[model samples]
Target: MSSSRIGLRFFQNSRAAFRNATGPFRRPGAQGFRFQSSDAASAEQQSTFQRLWNSPIGVKTVHFWAPVMKWALVIAGISDLGRPAEKLSLTQNGALTATGIIWTRWCMIITPKNYLLAAVNFFLGCVGVVQVTRIFNYRRSLKDSPVETVKELETEVVDQAKAVASEAEAAVKKSN
Candidate 1:
């Protein structure tokens, strides 16, 4: 009848639709029950499964390996740094000179490599933590949202359609 009533009815229908859409998650044997269609229902199920699999823990575990590998490489590089420079050449002066040259070259190379590894590890670890937080937040939001039953959604939709039809009829009579 009134605009407010119409708006309220629309919201009620929408809420009902939302509930029907999410109802399967609440109980067993609720599959195939949908306000939309079977295709939409299946899509929802697939997306939910995807979200679960891509959860914070999963993302963190995947991202963790990068830093671990980086650190291992760094440690190996450090062990190489400790080896005798004399092994590079034969005579003492020659060995000293060769070792100096080798050590200097290695030091130069390792400086940048170590920095790069540190930077990569820091970046990846930060990305992993952020992804973990995002997944957790998404899951929390989904859990907090209310789910509706199909029966309630059907009833609400029927009520809304009737209300809209009645409003149209009343408007026609008023115009007449």
Candidate 2:
């Protein structure tokens, strides 16, 4: 079977198990009434409910970030890499250090305003770095929290099932 079909089968089995374990908590006669419905109609209703309840909430948010961050990083890295080459060019002597010194002096003489501009750029770059870090961290936390929540929910369901089973067993023993 395809992965999605396998996933659907697993989901259906888990939901059925959950329902069976929590049967006593449901309204009296609800199960009997539900089972009397036409099979196709019931299946359709169950599928609709599953789609509504089980859809992941963060997928759209992740999709929005994926391309945005990818392009942002690519552009940022390319532009940053070009900065040094643009500012410093090789001299006729082919001395890299001398060329860099010449470029520094040239920048100071030709664009005194560049000092302020550089400061502003540096500040903005720092802000961008922090923002990107926070977004990455937020995504990681979002990924982790849901898994933890699902595990906790499953544990609670199992515990409730065990409690119900024990109660039922005790009641049966008493009746006998």
Candidate 3:
């Protein structure tokens, strides 16, 4: 599994997943190339890039996830301590941090001249991102036990030692 990092491709995939609500569709481009069916085809263009995906599908996704994310942010921020996993506490914090930055940026742009506060919030975003990144260091609970693993290693070592001893004894008898 990956130790998560944000990427443009991830956002693109997320947006596409929301738009299609199935998955990203690969299509043959007219110019003899591969492309995403959503963007490559002009006829099905739900909304332009400038609109920030306000189309029906996108709106539905946002509406569904917005409140959920808000509640999750509260819970994860309050209790989870950014627990890291494929789709657990780490994902929650990651989403929260990303949304915090987006909301802060939106506030900075929409509000009347709050550059100082925006700058502070930008720094807060940096802090949230750094904290969220800590999730990668977290270990899952339901994994193999270290003690059992060590015991298995010990058995293998003992068996190898016995094999080596038997080989040495055979060598000694042959020399005699």
Candidate 4:
């Protein structure tokens, strides 16, 4: 016999033994449906792939495909590993980290409890954090030298003054 058949036979025999052992302990008015061996046999005959495909969290459901689709983000993040830290966008990575954390938690509270989605989101958050940390450290290192810090402050002041002057010029032009 095939391994599946052998396993099914063992299961059936154990169930029967359990039912016999518990028969005397049943309440007088208690009623319950029993599975026929044939029904169990037919269910076992169905392939594992078929069973999974028909299941609640199977390929047909959004729970499955959504995680599959979200994997692209993880892949993209991984690909960015070679990218320069200076080129990394803090806001973009921050957004990914926030969404990943939020959705990973949401996955547990939602119906069917999509663990696959949670796993993908968790990895995505990890990738985002790694990139964010790299960017933050790179920016921090740039200001480590006093001269660089002074230059940055000077540039900020100059930029702000330019922006204010431009805004005043625009306001005067509009009033005229």
TM-score: model 4 vs. ground truth: 0.59
- Please name the candidate that would achieve the greatest lDDT relative to the true structure: 4
Q: Sorted on TM-score, highest at the top, how do the candidates line up?
A: 4, 3, 2, 1
Question: How does candidate 2 score on lDDT?
Answer: 0.46
Model 4 score (lDDT): 0.80
Question: Which prediction has the highest TM-score against the true structure?
Answer: 4
TM-score for each model: 0.20, 0.20, 0.27, 0.59
* Model 1 misplaced stretches (Cα beyond 4 Å): 1-60, 86-176
- Deviation from native of the Cα of residue 78 in model 2, angstroms: 25
Model 1, clash count? 1
Where does model 2 exceed 4 Å of error?
A: 1-113, 144-176
Global local distance difference test of model 3: 0.51
* lDDT for each candidate structure: 0.46, 0.46, 0.51, 0.80
Per-residue accuracy of model 4 over 18-99 as CA lDDT, tens digit each = 5655456654433332322224565588798866775678788898999999999999999998999988776678779988
How far does residue 172 in candidate 4 sit from its true spot (Å)?
29
Report the Cα lDDT for residue 165, model 3.
Answer: 95
Candidate 3: which stretches are off by over 4 Å?
Answer: 1-88, 115-120, 139-176
| Cα lDDT tens digits for candidate 2, 1-176 | 69999999999998877655535566443443322333456456676555434223222333224434444433553354334332322221123223333443543564223333233334334434444344334444655675665565457557767998999999999999
1-176: candidate 1 lDDT, tens digit per residue: 89999999999998777665654354433433222234446546666556445443233343335445655533443343344432321122222233333443443465224333345444434433433344334434545442433344346557767998999999999999
